[model samples]
Target chain A: MAGNVIEINNLTKRYGKHRGVEGVSFTVKEGDIFGFLGPNGAGKSTTIRSMLGFLGYEGEIKILGSDARSGHEKLMKNIGYMPSEAMFYPSMKVSEVIKLAADVRGTDCADEAGKLCERLKVDTSRSINELSLGNRKKVSIVCAMQHKPALFVFDEPTSGLDPLMQNTFFELIEEYVKQGTTCLLSTHVLSEVKNYCKNVAIMKEGKLISCGSVDELTHTNSKRVIVTADGKKSDYLYKGDMNSLIADLSGKNITQLDITDPSIEEIFMGYYEA
Target chain B: MITLFKHEFKQNLKSLLIWSISVGTLGLMCVLLYQSMTEDMQALSDSFSNMGAFSDAFGMSTLGIGTLKGYFATEVGAVHGIGSGMFAAIMATSLLSKEEDGHTGEFLYSLPVSITKVVAVKIAACITGLILFSVITGIFYISGVAYLGENFETDLFLKYMISVLLMNIEIACICVAFSAFVKKNMIGAGLGIALLFYFSDLICRISPDLKDYIVYGPYSLANATEIFVGNEIAASAYIISAVLIIAAVVTAFVKYTRKDLAS
Candidate 1:
């Protein structure tokens, strides 16, 4: 396995008396799609901001082998961050904004930016204020991917994108990750993580509750077993091996039987409930 | 830093032009009025003298309405001073706080730049806007005076203009520093600071004893008439203004760099 691209240890951010994120620790290995899952106000944005050095916080965060707080400028050169909300100067055209971003990063990303805009169907001639929410999101995505940074930090990256565009975005991410670019995707949605992410960390109320692969998490949780026999219907939570479950149920003379693995949503809900 | 500075300068260009045009128009009107007022200078001066406390309240007690320099100083200079100061404060405050208010802070802060560089470039942009505004207004005022065939000392006028520019920059730095402290009410805070400084100067003028204490006000530093006539130049006023500006800018840099930018 490659080394960790991002390592956060005991990270905490508090706003006066309010808890932002407390003792949040996680790691994303190079070339891995790591899902950071949490509900709204679960400190997902807070943690992302801390990693970007946009806020003051306790504990440690290292990105690309440098401390985020002290080496943010150097570290950010290799990081492409898409914030939850896409905002730009209202009076500036999309092209102007993209050019400004490219200029600040000291790179010539014109070709890549043009290609991304074409792929995403974004109109760069119009002013930012004139664009719709989805179009603005498309602009943001183009800006993030144009320079082709080694690490990507996307905070609810597909919120405003349409279903079709969301699929395209995932494909783009998959292609980039195939090239060995690491990604940290923060979202409240479970299906995206389950489908795309290799590993996931579940956070609730500013605390990390679980971190593991999808299969491991689902295997550790109880499975739903359904049986219909003699005009009676029953469901059971089966935790043991399949052979043991079959032996225990063999005497029931089942007319119909269905065994199913729980969805990621169900396991996530269990974590919240716990 | 250069990219950020250019972006900020371009962003504030429209407002800078508007303020310049407004200040220039007001100054031209004041200059035109000066021609007619000069015809009945004695009567006007006597009338102002008879107004007693009303004239004193507006700082007309020591003004000589007969002279072109005094008339321009008391009327056009006062308007430009307060107007430019207010405009500078508004511009600086908005430039500093608008990113967070408009939700663009996240985008800008995420770039490959230090917070110090960002703040410094923005401040430089604000200073550029103020300079443009001051220069535009000064050109109009000088043109107006010349159009009316008035004889005025060009050197003194330039010195007075420089003083006003310095005062505006000082007021802007103060407001920009205050921007780091407030989240939403930046405009209000800026206006409050400008108004308070102006009123404090007014009170100091009305009360002889308070003059020593209110010397930090921009009005005290950039007193147009005092600088125009080559009368006693308050060197300490310039020193104090410079100190305040330096202190405010340092505070802004420190606070903004360490601030928890939630937006």
Candidate 2:
């Protein structure tokens, strides 16, 4: 249990008993793309902030086999963080911001910065204030990934990205994983997590209500089935299955059914509904 | 910490330039005025008197308008005192609190540097700024003294000048400490300067009997004349001021290292 790259034990952060986060625990193995899945305000950001040593809390966290509180700076040097809401000076250019970040972090990654910029198709010449949300996200992503840190802590890194750019991000993540880097991805997008993460932890009401691999969590949950009958009538659903909600559309509806597994979103919803 | 200091210093070079120009130009202008008026001592004295007690309080009398201790006291308590102190205050406040206001602190917290390092480096930068004001103004003082008379005691002026330098550093440290607690640059600078100048007068108005107790005050430091005249500089006043500054800086460092930056 202790053989993990990141180990959080009994972490509790309370703001006048408002429960910023409470008694949350988790472990991330080396090279594990761990997904911290939760909706907004479900303590995802709180957990990440605490782990980064930005906040004092009543818990012990370790990063790369070192205590997060006592060994924060040394451990964090190996991490790349992309905050959910990225804020940069309006007057600074993207290139300028990236350079400043690298300077402060004691990293020299001009080549990596350039390569990431080129791959993401980001225009680094524009001022941050003049950038669109998606482009701003691109700047943040570039800043986070430029140095190829050992651990990548992303907070909604893909929220504003287009589908094409999202695919690019996934490619980058995959590339990084191949290089033996770990990722602790925090996001509400079940589909993205399901596709890319090796292990997933789900949170609800400031607690980890359910967590595990996609297959393990959803094995007994409801399966979705879609059937294509004939070209003339394509709508179809089984009418007699008590475990399923069936709908048979008339006029160009399917005449038969094709059974498929329920998506990660449905499984996540099921945890709350149950 | 050195890296942090360098980063802060580079970031503030422009502001330093502006302050430098202001001080340089002001010193140059005053020298020019002194040059034009040295022949007419009565006219100079009348002009200096007309400039008001506040101007006298600022050390404008150091130009030898009447060649009196009152003029030197005016210079010690007023111009160089307030001007240098305020400059140090601005520099220190801006260095510590701008990160929070710009939301840059959020991003920076994620980096590998500890907040302790950040605070230490920033304090060093504040001290550097303090020295800049003091050193640059020392240059002005020497040049102005040279303009006044060839026989002025350069050694005494230099010795007295260290007290003023230390006075500026004391003010800078207090402002930086205030900035760390408040986490707002403008408000921290405003309050720090106002408190430094205001409390000095407030204690004076309240009566000399209460002077020693207002240890949390920097107006005592502003009393550079008394300190430079080889007096003890009121040991309790300076000690109290030192204690307040140390407390602020320590608290800021502790808070910065542990404060949750999510917001």
Candidate 3:
């Protein structure tokens, strides 16, 4: 699929008896916004950390054709990562923190960093300790995107941002993705995935249960249908042709009929109940 | 490596300034007090010699307080040795653990630099801080001796300072190695290392028989009186200290690269 930017196979990480992620495998293609969808403690962070070489795992992970563990430093040059919690040296000014990140990458992104600061409404003069949680998150986003890396890995990046900032962040991602930057957005927010991601992998209990495009996943599953015929109310979970259901209900004195796609929560529940 | 070193040095500048000033002021004040007692040196020396165990407990028995170097070694040097050791231990331990404790590892570790480079730069930064502290304190000390109209033995003083710096480096390495394992509770780890070295030194001082067993402790490597008096320090002391520093640094590199950072 257009030269996979990330390839993970049977990646397993365990903390003693507790499993972090077990036998989780996935691939993200170039220029694709891959959504890693899972609830809390469902191994999203574990997998991300493993791919970044921050954790030791049992299986194989390759980022841009280099082994994640052996070629970590070389691979990290073109990868940008944003954690769920954004923390920096408390004594450093926001500008200094951003500068340090750029310096570490050995690339000057002052123009991009300044633009990001302006767009994100971040005050670069303020020390890290003086900023609020959302502002700290904004600073982190600036650091992650300033370099304009080939691959971006974000773990619940929008948790602390307000709605306006969230929209701005999505717009920034969209702009970058248009330039062919591959992104892996890991979050539990279904709407974010539905709105921004083309492909998604649903994980539960440290295992991947479903993986496919959003439209395929939603349409292939059961559809919720409601029919009001002569004041007789009934809820039906239909999995057949739409015409067959319509024909069955046409002769029953149908007064109203409604059909719609099920919510991600319902689809998730259906997978669990299966 | 240069960028990381600069950032780390800037991050640690405030602590380094405070430590250097405090130690320098202490050294200056001790020299001033020694000058005040110059006329009563004979009486003070007599009393100190007779105090016996009391003098030994504080490591004051070996040096004759009548002379300028002796008084400086017994009073100011002792404090500087112990204080600088504790400072180094705390600085090294906190430098590595603070990233994880403050949840900043994800930001730093995800960069293009190798973990080995990170550790090397940090250690270099810590050493730079210690060197600055020593230089500031040394200037204050030499100024005090010169003001008191006493001879400053440049060779002996340089040797003593080198020994003290080595002692601090050895302690710092040990703490850095310890920090790699104890990711959280860094304050506790720092304090634990300080107490271990301080008490080990005390035990060696209080008993002659235990000296052989505890010679590896950092305090014994550069005893103020031994170095100040031009006595030959055992080669074993230097060898063991070097071994400890090397072992600790190697352990830090191995553990940190393989660590599962929670951040």
- Give the number of the best model, judged by DockQ: 1
Q: Which stretches of candidate 3 lie over 4 Å from their true place?
A: A225-257, A272-274, B53-60
Writing each residue's lDDT as its tens digit, candidate 1 over A199-218 gives 98888999998888866765
Q: Cα deviation in Å at residue A143, candidate 3?
A: 1.2
Q: Per-model C-alpha lDDT, please?
A: 0.86, 0.71, 0.86
Docking quality band of candidate 2, CAPRI definitions: medium
DockQ of each: 0.84, 0.52, 0.78
Candidate 3 A-chain TM-score: 0.89
Name the better of 1 and 3 by TM-score. 1
For candidate 1, what is the lDDT? 0.86
Candidate 3 has which clashing residue pairs, if any?
none
Which candidate tops TM-score?
1
Candidate 3 lDDT, tens digit per residue, B1-263?
A: 89999998998899888887888788889998887788999788878867765567454577778888888888877778877877787788887887898888899988898878888999899999888878888888888888888786778888888888888899889988988887774766686787788777877776767768656788777777777777777888888998999999999989987899877
Q: What is the lDDT of residue B116 in candidate 1?
A: 89
TM-score between candidate 2 and the true structure: 0.82
- Which model is ahead, 2 or 3, in terms of TM-score? 3
Question: What tens-digit string does per-residue lDDT give for candidate 3 at A96-155?
Answer: 999999999989999999999989999999999999889999999999999999999999
Error of 3 at A93 (Å): 0.8
Among all windows of 10 consecutive residues in model 3 chain A, the one with the lowest summed lDDT is A265-274
The stretch of ten residues in a row with the least summed lDDT in candidate 1 chain A is A213-222
Task: Tell me the deviation in Å of residue A149 in model 1.
Answer: 0.4
